[model samples]
Target: MKINYPDGRIFNSQPSKSSLHTTNAKKKLIFGDRGMTLEEEINESNKYYRAHDIAVIYKKPTPIQIVKVDYPKRSKAVIREAYFRQASTTDYNGVYNGYYVDFEAKETKNKNTFPLKNFHQHQIDHLKMCQKQGGICFVIIKYVELKRYFVMPADEIFIHWDAQFDGAKSIQLKDIEKGSIEIKADYNPTLPYINAVQQLIESGKEKK
Candidate 1:
Protein backbone atom coordinates (compact mmCIF):
# COMPACT_ATOMS: atom_id res chain seq x y z
CA MET A 1 0.00 0.00 0.00
CA LYS A 2 1.13 3.52 -0.80
CA ILE A 3 -0.07 6.80 0.60
CA ASN A 4 0.29 10.19 -1.02
CA TYR A 5 -0.56 13.62 0.23
CA PRO A 6 -2.96 15.86 -1.65
CA ASP A 7 0.01 18.03 -2.66
CA GLY A 8 1.47 15.32 -4.91
CA ARG A 9 4.05 14.03 -2.46
CA ILE A 10 4.37 10.45 -1.25
CA PHE A 11 3.81 10.15 2.50
CA ASN A 12 3.63 6.39 3.06
CA SER A 13 7.19 5.51 4.00
CA GLN A 14 9.75 6.85 6.42
CA PRO A 15 13.43 6.17 7.00
CA SER A 16 14.06 3.15 9.19
CA LYS A 17 15.58 3.82 12.61
CA SER A 18 16.46 0.23 13.32
CA SER A 19 19.98 -0.97 13.90
CA LEU A 20 19.45 -3.61 11.26
CA HIS A 21 18.75 -0.95 8.63
CA THR A 22 21.86 -0.58 6.47
CA THR A 23 23.02 2.78 5.17
CA ASN A 24 25.72 4.50 3.08
CA ALA A 25 27.65 1.26 2.41
CA LYS A 26 28.43 1.07 6.09
CA LYS A 27 27.09 -0.69 9.16
CA LYS A 28 24.22 1.58 10.12
CA LEU A 29 23.25 0.74 13.69
CA ILE A 30 23.86 -1.56 16.64
CA PHE A 31 21.53 -3.77 18.69
CA GLY A 32 23.95 -6.26 20.14
CA ASP A 33 22.23 -9.69 20.16
CA ARG A 34 18.57 -8.82 20.59
CA GLY A 35 18.55 -6.98 17.26
CA MET A 36 15.64 -4.84 18.30
CA THR A 37 15.08 -1.28 17.24
CA LEU A 38 14.76 1.44 19.86
CA GLU A 39 11.03 1.67 19.29
CA GLU A 40 10.61 -2.10 19.58
CA GLU A 41 12.52 -2.22 22.83
CA ILE A 42 10.38 0.58 24.22
CA ASN A 43 7.18 -1.10 23.13
CA GLU A 44 8.19 -4.30 24.88
CA SER A 45 8.99 -2.33 28.00
CA ASN A 46 5.66 -0.52 27.87
CA LYS A 47 3.89 -3.87 27.81
CA TYR A 48 5.85 -4.98 30.85
CA TYR A 49 4.90 -1.79 32.67
CA ARG A 50 1.21 -2.21 31.91
CA ALA A 51 1.11 -5.84 33.02
CA HIS A 52 2.75 -5.12 36.38
CA ASP A 53 0.85 -1.90 37.11
CA ILE A 54 4.01 0.21 37.11
CA ALA A 55 2.95 2.71 34.43
CA VAL A 56 0.35 3.16 31.76
CA ILE A 57 2.40 4.36 28.82
CA TYR A 58 1.62 3.75 25.18
CA LYS A 59 2.67 4.76 21.70
CA LYS A 60 0.52 7.56 20.34
CA PRO A 61 -1.05 6.48 17.10
CA THR A 62 -0.99 9.00 14.29
CA PRO A 63 -4.31 9.52 12.57
CA ILE A 64 -4.37 9.07 8.81
CA GLN A 65 -6.41 11.07 6.31
CA ILE A 66 -7.93 8.68 3.84
CA VAL A 67 -7.80 9.88 0.23
CA LYS A 68 -8.53 6.70 -1.71
CA VAL A 69 -9.92 3.26 -1.13
CA ASP A 70 -10.62 0.34 -3.45
CA TYR A 71 -13.28 -2.24 -2.92
CA PRO A 72 -11.23 -5.23 -4.05
CA LYS A 73 -13.95 -7.56 -2.76
CA ARG A 74 -17.31 -7.18 -1.15
CA SER A 75 -15.83 -8.07 2.22
CA LYS A 76 -12.56 -6.22 1.83
CA ALA A 77 -11.56 -2.61 1.21
CA VAL A 78 -7.97 -1.65 0.46
CA ILE A 79 -6.65 1.72 1.41
CA ARG A 80 -4.82 3.10 -1.62
CA GLU A 81 -4.01 6.65 -0.53
CA ALA A 82 -3.75 8.46 2.74
CA TYR A 83 -1.71 10.99 4.67
CA PHE A 84 -1.11 11.90 8.26
CA ARG A 85 -4.11 13.87 9.44
CA GLN A 86 -1.88 16.37 11.21
CA ALA A 87 1.67 16.83 12.43
CA SER A 88 1.97 14.56 15.43
CA THR A 89 3.61 15.61 18.65
CA THR A 90 5.51 13.14 20.83
CA ASP A 91 5.78 9.41 20.27
CA TYR A 92 4.40 8.26 23.61
CA ASN A 93 2.43 9.75 26.50
CA GLY A 94 0.63 8.44 29.58
CA VAL A 95 0.45 8.44 33.38
CA TYR A 96 3.19 7.10 35.63
CA ASN A 97 3.02 7.31 39.39
CA GLY A 98 0.51 10.12 39.26
CA TYR A 99 2.67 12.23 36.88
CA TYR A 100 2.17 12.72 33.19
CA VAL A 101 4.94 11.13 31.17
CA ASP A 102 5.57 12.33 27.64
CA PHE A 103 8.54 11.56 25.41
CA GLU A 104 10.01 10.87 21.99
CA ALA A 105 12.32 8.01 21.07
CA LYS A 106 15.18 8.42 18.62
CA GLU A 107 18.02 6.25 17.36
CA THR A 108 21.29 7.51 15.87
CA LYS A 109 24.40 5.84 14.51
CA ASN A 110 26.68 8.64 15.59
CA LYS A 111 28.98 7.54 18.38
CA ASN A 112 29.82 10.94 19.84
CA THR A 113 26.74 13.03 19.20
CA PHE A 114 23.00 12.90 18.72
CA PRO A 115 21.98 15.11 15.82
CA LEU A 116 19.43 17.80 16.54
CA LYS A 117 18.05 17.30 13.05
CA ASN A 118 16.36 14.15 14.34
CA PHE A 119 13.81 16.41 16.06
CA HIS A 120 11.27 18.85 14.68
CA GLN A 121 10.34 22.23 16.10
CA HIS A 122 6.75 21.15 16.71
CA GLN A 123 7.94 18.28 18.93
CA ILE A 124 10.17 20.60 20.91
CA ASP A 125 7.33 23.04 21.37
CA HIS A 126 4.94 20.29 22.41
CA LEU A 127 7.37 18.92 24.98
CA LYS A 128 7.96 22.41 26.31
CA MET A 129 4.25 22.89 26.74
CA CYS A 130 3.89 19.52 28.46
CA GLN A 131 6.72 20.35 30.83
CA LYS A 132 5.09 23.67 31.66
CA GLN A 133 1.97 21.83 32.73
CA GLY A 134 3.97 19.68 35.23
CA GLY A 135 4.48 16.67 32.99
CA ILE A 136 7.62 14.56 33.14
CA CYS A 137 8.84 15.29 29.67
CA PHE A 138 12.01 13.93 28.11
CA VAL A 139 13.64 12.18 25.17
CA ILE A 140 14.87 8.59 25.05
CA ILE A 141 17.91 8.55 22.80
CA LYS A 142 19.49 5.35 21.54
CA TYR A 143 23.12 5.58 20.50
CA VAL A 144 23.21 2.69 18.09
CA GLU A 145 26.92 2.71 17.48
CA LEU A 146 27.75 2.62 21.15
CA LYS A 147 24.71 0.50 22.02
CA ARG A 148 23.85 2.89 24.84
CA TYR A 149 20.66 4.52 25.95
CA PHE A 150 19.98 7.79 27.74
CA VAL A 151 16.91 9.38 29.22
CA MET A 152 17.51 13.09 28.79
CA PRO A 153 15.36 15.71 30.40
CA ALA A 154 13.44 18.04 28.10
CA ASP A 155 15.33 21.08 29.44
CA GLU A 156 18.63 19.77 28.07
CA ILE A 157 17.03 19.21 24.70
CA PHE A 158 15.69 22.78 24.67
CA ILE A 159 19.14 24.15 25.43
CA HIS A 160 20.65 22.32 22.46
CA TRP A 161 17.73 23.20 20.20
CA ASP A 162 18.12 26.90 21.07
CA ALA A 163 21.89 26.69 20.53
CA GLN A 164 21.31 25.46 16.98
CA PHE A 165 20.84 29.12 16.05
CA ASP A 166 24.43 29.69 17.26
CA GLY A 167 25.75 26.79 15.10
CA ALA A 168 25.47 23.83 17.47
CA LYS A 169 23.89 21.16 15.35
CA SER A 170 24.14 18.28 17.80
CA ILE A 171 24.36 17.44 21.47
CA GLN A 172 27.67 16.04 22.64
CA LEU A 173 27.72 12.57 24.22
CA LYS A 174 29.61 13.84 27.25
CA ASP A 175 26.95 16.46 27.92
CA ILE A 176 24.27 13.81 27.64
CA GLU A 177 26.18 11.58 30.04
CA LYS A 178 26.34 14.42 32.52
CA GLY A 179 22.80 15.71 32.24
CA SER A 180 20.94 12.47 31.57
CA ILE A 181 20.47 9.10 33.20
CA GLU A 182 21.91 6.14 31.38
CA ILE A 183 19.81 2.95 31.47
CA LYS A 184 21.07 -0.43 30.49
CA ALA A 185 18.98 -2.36 27.97
CA ASP A 186 17.71 -5.19 30.20
CA TYR A 187 15.24 -8.07 30.46
CA ASN A 188 11.50 -8.20 31.49
CA PRO A 189 11.40 -4.42 30.92
CA THR A 190 13.81 -4.00 28.06
CA LEU A 191 14.39 -0.25 28.50
CA PRO A 192 13.93 0.23 32.28
CA TYR A 193 13.38 3.93 31.53
CA ILE A 194 10.92 4.57 34.33
CA ASN A 195 13.80 4.39 36.80
CA ALA A 196 15.28 7.31 34.94
CA VAL A 197 11.91 9.00 35.14
CA GLN A 198 12.06 8.60 38.91
CA GLN A 199 15.46 10.26 38.80
CA LEU A 200 14.03 13.11 36.79
CA ILE A 201 11.24 13.52 39.32
CA GLU A 202 13.71 13.52 42.21
CA SER A 203 16.03 15.91 40.37
CA GLY A 204 13.11 18.26 39.84
CA LYS A 205 12.42 18.24 43.53
CA GLU A 206 16.03 19.12 44.19
CA LYS A 207 15.74 22.04 41.80
CA LYS A 208 12.72 23.34 43.72
Candidate 2:
Protein backbone atom coordinates (compact mmCIF):
# COMPACT_ATOMS: atom_id res chain seq x y z
CA MET A 1 0.00 0.00 0.00
CA LYS A 2 1.35 3.38 -1.02
CA ILE A 3 0.20 6.80 0.14
CA ASN A 4 1.45 9.82 -1.70
CA TYR A 5 1.83 12.85 0.51
CA PRO A 6 1.22 16.40 -0.67
CA ASP A 7 4.99 16.77 -0.86
CA GLY A 8 5.09 14.08 -3.56
CA ARG A 9 6.68 11.59 -1.22
CA ILE A 10 5.09 8.18 -1.32
CA PHE A 11 4.93 6.29 1.95
CA ASN A 12 4.48 2.55 2.24
CA SER A 13 4.24 2.70 6.02
CA GLN A 14 3.22 5.24 8.64
CA PRO A 15 6.72 5.48 10.12
CA SER A 16 8.08 6.62 6.77
CA LYS A 17 6.18 9.85 7.14
CA SER A 18 7.69 13.05 8.49
CA SER A 19 5.84 13.28 11.80
CA LEU A 20 7.01 10.12 13.60
CA HIS A 21 10.40 8.92 14.81
CA THR A 22 11.61 5.77 16.53
CA THR A 23 14.71 5.53 18.64
CA ASN A 24 16.99 2.53 18.43
CA ALA A 25 18.46 2.95 21.90
CA LYS A 26 20.99 0.16 21.42
CA LYS A 27 22.27 1.63 18.18
CA LYS A 28 21.84 5.17 19.50
CA LEU A 29 19.99 6.18 16.35
CA ILE A 30 16.79 8.07 15.73
CA PHE A 31 15.34 6.87 12.47
CA GLY A 32 12.14 7.44 10.54
CA ASP A 33 10.85 5.03 7.93
CA ARG A 34 7.88 4.47 5.65
CA GLY A 35 6.30 1.52 7.41
CA MET A 36 3.47 1.06 9.85
CA THR A 37 4.67 0.37 13.33
CA LEU A 38 1.66 0.56 15.68
CA GLU A 39 3.04 3.78 17.15
CA GLU A 40 3.41 5.25 13.69
CA GLU A 41 -0.18 4.41 12.80
CA ILE A 42 -1.53 6.24 15.83
CA ASN A 43 0.75 9.18 15.19
CA GLU A 44 -0.48 9.33 11.62
CA SER A 45 -4.08 9.24 12.80
CA ASN A 46 -3.33 12.13 15.15
CA LYS A 47 -1.80 13.98 12.23
CA TYR A 48 -5.00 13.50 10.30
CA TYR A 49 -6.93 15.05 13.14
CA ARG A 50 -4.55 17.99 13.30
CA ALA A 51 -4.75 18.65 9.56
CA HIS A 52 -8.52 18.84 9.79
CA ASP A 53 -8.19 21.23 12.74
CA ILE A 54 -10.07 18.72 14.84
CA ALA A 55 -7.40 18.19 17.54
CA VAL A 56 -3.82 18.62 18.63
CA ILE A 57 -2.03 15.64 20.13
CA TYR A 58 1.45 14.16 20.22
CA LYS A 59 3.44 11.35 21.81
CA LYS A 60 5.35 12.23 24.94
CA PRO A 61 9.08 11.68 24.66
CA THR A 62 10.15 9.27 27.35
CA PRO A 63 11.82 11.08 30.25
CA ILE A 64 15.33 9.72 30.64
CA GLN A 65 18.10 10.34 33.14
CA ILE A 66 21.34 10.69 31.24
CA VAL A 67 24.17 8.99 33.06
CA LYS A 68 27.03 9.36 30.63
CA VAL A 69 27.68 11.30 27.44
CA ASP A 70 30.58 11.01 24.98
CA TYR A 71 31.55 13.76 22.58
CA PRO A 72 33.66 12.09 19.98
CA LYS A 73 33.64 15.08 17.67
CA ARG A 74 32.59 18.75 17.78
CA SER A 75 29.21 18.36 16.12
CA LYS A 76 27.44 15.70 18.15
CA ALA A 77 27.47 14.47 21.73
CA VAL A 78 26.43 10.83 22.10
CA ILE A 79 24.43 9.78 25.11
CA ARG A 80 26.17 6.60 26.26
CA GLU A 81 23.61 5.41 28.74
CA ALA A 82 20.44 6.56 30.41
CA TYR A 83 17.64 5.28 32.58
CA PHE A 84 13.98 6.17 32.66
CA ARG A 85 13.18 8.92 35.13
CA GLN A 86 9.81 7.35 35.74
CA ALA A 87 7.20 5.18 34.11
CA SER A 88 5.56 7.09 31.27
CA THR A 89 1.97 8.20 31.03
CA THR A 90 -0.11 7.65 27.91
CA ASP A 91 1.18 7.78 24.37
CA TYR A 92 -0.72 10.97 23.49
CA ASN A 93 -2.83 13.80 24.87
CA GLY A 94 -4.21 17.13 23.68
CA VAL A 95 -7.26 19.41 23.41
CA TYR A 96 -10.12 18.76 21.04
CA ASN A 97 -13.53 20.33 20.69
CA GLY A 98 -12.77 22.40 23.79
CA TYR A 99 -12.22 19.22 25.83
CA TYR A 100 -9.01 17.60 27.03
CA VAL A 101 -8.32 14.14 25.60
CA ASP A 102 -5.84 11.63 26.95
CA PHE A 103 -5.21 8.10 25.78
CA GLU A 104 -2.70 5.28 25.58
CA ALA A 105 -2.18 3.17 22.45
CA LYS A 106 -1.25 -0.45 22.98
CA GLU A 107 -1.01 -3.49 20.73
CA THR A 108 -1.13 -7.13 21.72
CA LYS A 109 -0.26 -10.15 19.63
CA ASN A 110 -2.09 -12.41 22.03
CA LYS A 111 -5.37 -13.75 20.68
CA ASN A 112 -7.30 -14.09 23.89
CA THR A 113 -6.75 -10.99 26.01
CA PHE A 114 -4.64 -7.91 26.49
CA PRO A 115 -2.47 -8.29 29.55
CA LEU A 116 -2.76 -5.55 32.17
CA LYS A 117 1.01 -5.62 32.46
CA ASN A 118 1.22 -3.65 29.22
CA PHE A 119 0.02 -0.62 31.19
CA HIS A 120 2.00 0.91 34.04
CA GLN A 121 0.82 2.24 37.39
CA HIS A 122 2.01 5.74 36.59
CA GLN A 123 -0.11 5.63 33.47
CA ILE A 124 -3.18 4.68 35.44
CA ASP A 125 -2.42 7.42 37.98
CA HIS A 126 -2.02 9.96 35.19
CA LEU A 127 -5.31 8.97 33.62
CA LYS A 128 -7.04 9.22 36.99
CA MET A 129 -5.62 12.69 37.48
CA CYS A 130 -6.78 13.72 34.03
CA GLN A 131 -10.25 12.37 34.75
CA LYS A 132 -10.29 14.36 37.97
CA GLN A 133 -9.39 17.43 35.91
CA GLY A 134 -12.49 16.90 33.74
CA GLY A 135 -10.57 15.42 30.85
CA ILE A 136 -11.47 12.35 28.80
CA CYS A 137 -9.20 9.41 29.51
CA PHE A 138 -9.17 6.16 27.59
CA VAL A 139 -7.05 3.39 26.12
CA ILE A 140 -6.74 2.55 22.43
CA ILE A 141 -6.21 -1.17 22.45
CA LYS A 142 -5.25 -3.01 19.28
CA TYR A 143 -5.74 -6.70 18.93
CA VAL A 144 -3.06 -7.05 16.31
CA GLU A 145 -3.95 -10.62 15.56
CA LEU A 146 -7.48 -9.60 14.75
CA LYS A 147 -6.51 -6.26 13.22
CA ARG A 148 -9.14 -4.60 15.35
CA TYR A 149 -8.95 -1.73 17.81
CA PHE A 150 -11.10 -0.43 20.63
CA VAL A 151 -11.42 2.70 22.72
CA MET A 152 -12.12 1.95 26.38
CA PRO A 153 -12.82 4.61 28.96
CA ALA A 154 -10.59 4.99 31.96
CA ASP A 155 -13.45 4.39 34.37
CA GLU A 156 -14.04 0.94 32.92
CA ILE A 157 -10.33 0.21 33.04
CA PHE A 158 -10.03 1.33 36.65
CA ILE A 159 -12.70 -1.11 37.77
CA HIS A 160 -10.83 -4.08 36.35
CA TRP A 161 -7.49 -2.77 37.54
CA ASP A 162 -8.84 -2.40 41.07
CA ALA A 163 -9.96 -6.01 40.88
CA GLN A 164 -6.36 -7.06 40.34
CA PHE A 165 -5.92 -6.92 44.10
CA ASP A 166 -8.53 -9.73 44.35
CA GLY A 167 -6.26 -11.86 42.09
CA ALA A 168 -7.42 -10.95 38.57
CA LYS A 169 -4.31 -10.47 36.51
CA SER A 170 -5.93 -9.62 33.20
CA ILE A 171 -9.15 -8.40 31.67
CA GLN A 172 -11.06 -10.88 29.55
CA LEU A 173 -11.96 -10.38 25.89
CA LYS A 174 -15.61 -10.50 26.82
CA ASP A 175 -15.12 -7.62 29.20
CA ILE A 176 -13.54 -5.53 26.49
CA GLU A 177 -16.34 -6.47 24.12
CA LYS A 178 -18.87 -5.06 26.56
CA GLY A 179 -16.99 -1.94 27.57
CA SER A 180 -15.04 -0.76 24.57
CA ILE A 181 -15.91 1.05 21.33
CA GLU A 182 -14.29 -0.93 18.56
CA ILE A 183 -12.69 0.75 15.55
CA LYS A 184 -11.93 -0.75 12.16
CA ALA A 185 -8.92 0.01 9.98
CA ASP A 186 -9.30 2.19 6.87
CA TYR A 187 -7.44 3.38 3.81
CA ASN A 188 -7.71 7.19 3.62
CA PRO A 189 -6.23 7.83 7.06
CA THR A 190 -5.54 4.23 8.06
CA LEU A 191 -7.04 3.80 11.56
CA PRO A 192 -10.15 5.94 12.07
CA TYR A 193 -9.31 6.88 15.66
CA ILE A 194 -10.93 10.30 15.67
CA ASN A 195 -14.23 8.56 15.09
CA ALA A 196 -13.63 6.61 18.29
CA VAL A 197 -12.91 9.86 20.08
CA GLN A 198 -16.13 11.31 18.76
CA GLN A 199 -18.06 8.34 20.02
CA LEU A 200 -16.42 8.62 23.43
CA ILE A 201 -17.27 12.34 23.68
CA GLU A 202 -20.86 11.72 22.65
CA SER A 203 -21.19 8.93 25.19
CA GLY A 204 -19.87 11.23 27.90
CA LYS A 205 -22.42 13.84 26.90
CA GLU A 206 -25.18 11.25 27.12
CA LYS A 207 -24.16 10.35 30.66
CA LYS A 208 -24.65 13.91 31.82
Candidate 3:
Protein backbone atom coordinates (compact mmCIF):
# COMPACT_ATOMS: atom_id res chain seq x y z
CA MET A 1 0.00 0.00 0.00
CA LYS A 2 1.29 3.43 -0.92
CA ILE A 3 0.04 6.86 0.02
CA ASN A 4 0.99 9.95 -1.92
CA TYR A 5 -0.06 13.24 -0.38
CA PRO A 6 -1.41 16.01 -2.61
CA ASP A 7 1.55 18.10 -1.45
CA GLY A 8 4.09 15.65 -2.95
CA ARG A 9 4.63 13.99 0.43
CA ILE A 10 4.31 10.42 1.64
CA PHE A 11 1.93 9.13 4.30
CA ASN A 12 2.37 10.70 7.70
CA SER A 13 1.71 7.55 9.66
CA GLN A 14 3.51 8.25 12.92
CA PRO A 15 5.65 11.00 14.32
CA SER A 16 9.39 10.46 14.05
CA LYS A 17 11.30 10.39 17.33
CA SER A 18 13.38 13.43 16.42
CA SER A 19 10.26 15.43 15.55
CA LEU A 20 8.49 14.39 18.78
CA HIS A 21 11.22 15.58 21.13
CA THR A 22 13.27 18.75 21.50
CA THR A 23 16.42 19.30 19.44
CA ASN A 24 18.48 18.89 22.63
CA ALA A 25 17.68 15.17 22.53
CA LYS A 26 19.69 14.83 19.31
CA LYS A 27 22.80 16.52 20.74
CA LYS A 28 22.57 14.88 24.18
CA LEU A 29 23.85 11.40 24.96
CA ILE A 30 20.35 9.93 25.36
CA PHE A 31 21.39 6.32 24.60
CA GLY A 32 17.75 5.57 23.81
CA ASP A 33 17.93 3.23 20.80
CA ARG A 34 18.68 0.25 23.06
CA GLY A 35 15.26 -0.27 24.67
CA MET A 36 11.62 0.76 25.07
CA THR A 37 10.67 4.40 25.45
CA LEU A 38 9.34 5.55 28.83
CA GLU A 39 5.88 5.95 27.30
CA GLU A 40 5.94 2.38 25.96
CA GLU A 41 7.10 0.97 29.28
CA ILE A 42 4.30 2.70 31.16
CA ASN A 43 1.73 1.60 28.60
CA GLU A 44 2.80 -2.03 28.89
CA SER A 45 2.54 -1.82 32.64
CA ASN A 46 -0.87 -0.24 32.37
CA LYS A 47 -2.04 -3.20 30.33
CA TYR A 48 -0.73 -5.59 32.95
CA TYR A 49 -2.40 -3.64 35.71
CA ARG A 50 -5.69 -3.76 33.88
CA ALA A 51 -5.52 -7.54 33.56
CA HIS A 52 -4.53 -8.11 37.18
CA ASP A 53 -7.10 -5.72 38.70
CA ILE A 54 -4.40 -3.50 40.17
CA ALA A 55 -5.25 -0.16 38.53
CA VAL A 56 -7.09 1.22 35.55
CA ILE A 57 -4.47 3.54 34.18
CA TYR A 58 -4.08 4.25 30.49
CA LYS A 59 -2.12 6.46 28.13
CA LYS A 60 -4.38 9.22 26.89
CA PRO A 61 -4.35 9.00 23.12
CA THR A 62 -3.25 12.11 21.27
CA PRO A 63 -6.02 13.33 19.01
CA ILE A 64 -4.93 13.46 15.37
CA GLN A 65 -6.58 15.50 12.64
CA ILE A 66 -6.55 13.72 9.31
CA VAL A 67 -6.24 16.13 6.43
CA LYS A 68 -5.98 13.51 3.69
CA VAL A 69 -6.58 9.79 3.37
CA ASP A 70 -6.11 7.21 0.63
CA TYR A 71 -8.20 4.06 0.30
CA PRO A 72 -6.33 1.61 -1.87
CA LYS A 73 -8.53 -1.30 -0.77
CA ARG A 74 -12.12 -1.55 0.37
CA SER A 75 -11.02 -2.10 3.99
CA LYS A 76 -7.59 -0.47 4.10
CA ALA A 77 -7.12 3.24 4.37
CA VAL A 78 -3.88 5.20 4.70
CA ILE A 79 -3.56 8.64 6.14
CA ARG A 80 -1.73 10.85 3.67
CA GLU A 81 -1.83 14.00 5.73
CA ALA A 82 -2.45 14.46 9.47
CA TYR A 83 -1.61 16.68 12.43
CA PHE A 84 -1.95 16.53 16.18
CA ARG A 85 -5.02 18.31 17.50
CA GLN A 86 -3.44 19.88 20.58
CA ALA A 87 -0.61 19.60 23.09
CA SER A 88 -1.60 16.86 25.50
CA THR A 89 -1.56 17.89 29.12
CA THR A 90 -0.43 14.72 30.90
CA ASP A 91 0.59 11.22 29.94
CA TYR A 92 -1.37 8.69 32.04
CA ASN A 93 -4.37 9.14 34.32
CA GLY A 94 -6.89 6.83 35.97
CA VAL A 95 -8.19 5.32 39.22
CA TYR A 96 -6.16 3.40 41.78
CA ASN A 97 -7.50 2.25 45.18
CA GLY A 98 -10.38 4.68 45.03
CA TYR A 99 -8.06 7.59 44.25
CA TYR A 100 -7.61 9.51 41.06
CA VAL A 101 -4.08 8.96 39.73
CA ASP A 102 -2.53 11.36 37.26
CA PHE A 103 1.07 11.55 36.10
CA GLU A 104 3.51 12.43 33.37
CA ALA A 105 6.35 10.13 32.36
CA LYS A 106 9.71 11.56 31.30
CA GLU A 107 13.11 10.08 30.54
CA THR A 108 16.42 11.90 30.31
CA LYS A 109 20.00 11.09 29.37
CA ASN A 110 21.69 13.51 31.74
CA LYS A 111 23.65 11.82 34.50
CA ASN A 112 23.74 14.71 36.96
CA THR A 113 20.26 16.15 36.69
CA PHE A 114 16.91 15.75 34.96
CA PRO A 115 16.52 18.79 32.72
CA LEU A 116 13.43 20.84 33.59
CA LYS A 117 13.31 21.79 29.93
CA ASN A 118 11.78 18.36 29.32
CA PHE A 119 8.53 19.60 30.90
CA HIS A 120 6.02 22.16 29.73
CA GLN A 121 4.14 24.79 31.75
CA HIS A 122 0.73 23.41 30.75
CA GLN A 123 1.63 19.97 32.09
CA ILE A 124 2.61 21.52 35.40
CA ASP A 125 -0.65 23.45 35.53
CA HIS A 126 -2.62 20.29 34.86
CA LEU A 127 -0.90 18.60 37.76
CA LYS A 128 -1.77 21.56 39.97
CA MET A 129 -5.46 21.29 39.10
CA CYS A 130 -5.47 17.55 39.74
CA GLN A 131 -3.69 17.98 43.07
CA LYS A 132 -6.20 20.57 44.22
CA GLN A 133 -8.98 18.16 43.40
CA GLY A 134 -7.29 15.65 45.76
CA GLY A 135 -5.90 13.58 42.94
CA ILE A 136 -2.61 11.76 43.42
CA CYS A 137 -0.38 13.53 40.91
CA PHE A 138 3.28 12.84 40.18
CA VAL A 139 5.89 12.33 37.48
CA ILE A 140 7.75 9.14 36.59
CA ILE A 141 11.31 9.95 35.52
CA LYS A 142 13.69 7.48 33.95
CA TYR A 143 17.43 8.10 33.62
CA VAL A 144 18.37 6.39 30.37
CA GLU A 145 22.10 5.95 30.93
CA LEU A 146 21.72 5.20 34.62
CA LYS A 147 18.80 2.74 34.31
CA ARG A 148 17.12 4.39 37.26
CA TYR A 149 13.44 5.19 37.85
CA PHE A 150 11.92 7.64 40.29
CA VAL A 151 8.39 8.87 41.02
CA MET A 152 8.61 12.50 42.04
CA PRO A 153 5.54 14.11 43.54
CA ALA A 154 3.93 16.99 41.70
CA ASP A 155 4.79 19.39 44.53
CA GLU A 156 8.52 18.77 44.09
CA ILE A 157 8.11 19.28 40.37
CA PHE A 158 6.36 22.61 40.94
CA ILE A 159 9.21 23.77 43.18
CA HIS A 160 11.83 23.10 40.51
CA TRP A 161 9.65 24.36 37.65
CA ASP A 162 9.29 27.74 39.35
CA ALA A 163 12.99 27.88 40.28
CA GLN A 164 13.91 27.46 36.62
CA PHE A 165 12.96 31.09 36.16
CA ASP A 166 15.52 32.04 38.84
CA GLY A 167 18.39 30.07 37.19
CA ALA A 168 17.70 26.43 38.14
CA LYS A 169 17.63 24.66 34.81
CA SER A 170 17.41 21.15 36.25
CA ILE A 171 16.78 19.05 39.34
CA GLN A 172 19.90 17.59 40.89
CA LEU A 173 20.07 13.82 41.21
CA LYS A 174 20.56 14.14 44.96
CA ASP A 175 17.51 16.38 45.31
CA ILE A 176 15.43 13.95 43.27
CA GLU A 177 16.64 11.11 45.48
CA LYS A 178 15.56 12.96 48.60
CA GLY A 179 12.19 14.08 47.32
CA SER A 180 11.03 11.07 45.33
CA ILE A 181 10.25 7.38 45.67
CA GLU A 182 12.52 5.01 43.78
CA ILE A 183 11.06 2.06 41.87
CA LYS A 184 13.01 -1.02 40.88
CA ALA A 185 11.97 -2.15 37.43
CA ASP A 186 11.03 -5.81 37.32
CA TYR A 187 9.64 -8.60 35.13
CA ASN A 188 5.87 -8.91 35.78
CA PRO A 189 4.34 -5.52 35.01
CA THR A 190 7.75 -4.17 33.97
CA LEU A 191 8.00 -0.96 36.02
CA PRO A 192 5.89 -1.38 39.19
CA TYR A 193 5.23 2.35 39.53
CA ILE A 194 1.90 1.78 41.31
CA ASN A 195 3.89 0.85 44.42
CA ALA A 196 5.33 4.34 44.44
CA VAL A 197 1.82 5.70 44.00
CA GLN A 198 0.85 3.86 47.16
CA GLN A 199 3.69 5.55 49.00
CA LEU A 200 2.55 8.95 47.76
CA ILE A 201 -0.97 8.31 49.07
CA GLU A 202 0.40 7.30 52.45
CA SER A 203 2.63 10.36 52.61
CA GLY A 204 -0.32 12.60 51.85
CA LYS A 205 -2.18 11.09 54.77
CA GLU A 206 0.86 11.66 56.99
CA LYS A 207 1.03 15.32 55.97
CA LYS A 208 -2.61 15.80 56.79
Best candidate, lDDT = 1
1-208, model 1: which lDDT tens digit per residue? 2311122111212323332244431211232226667876787688779878999998776567899999976578989998766555898899999999999999898999888999999899999999999999999999997999999999999999999999999999999999889999987687899999999999899999
Best-matching candidate per TM-score: 1
The 10-residue segment of model 3 with minimum total lDDT is 3-12
Residue-level lDDT of model 3, residues 78-142, one tens digit each, is 99999866555796899998999999999998897889989998899999999999999999999
User: Local distance difference test, per candidate?
Assistant: 0.81, 0.75, 0.80
Q: In candidate 2, what residue range of length 10 has the lowest lDDT sum? A: 25-34
Q: In model 3, where do residues sit more than 4 Å from their true spots?
A: 1-34, 70-73
User: Residue 40 of candidate 3: its Cα lDDT?
Assistant: 54
Span of ten consecutive residues with least summed lDDT in model 1: 3-12
Models ranked on TM-score: 1, 3, 2
Residue 193 miss distance in model 2 (angstroms)? 1.3
Query: To one decimal, what is the Cα RMSD in angstroms of model 3 from the true structure?
Result: 8.7
Query: Which pairs of residues have clashing backbones in candidate 3?
Result: none
Better of 1 and 3 by TM-score: 1
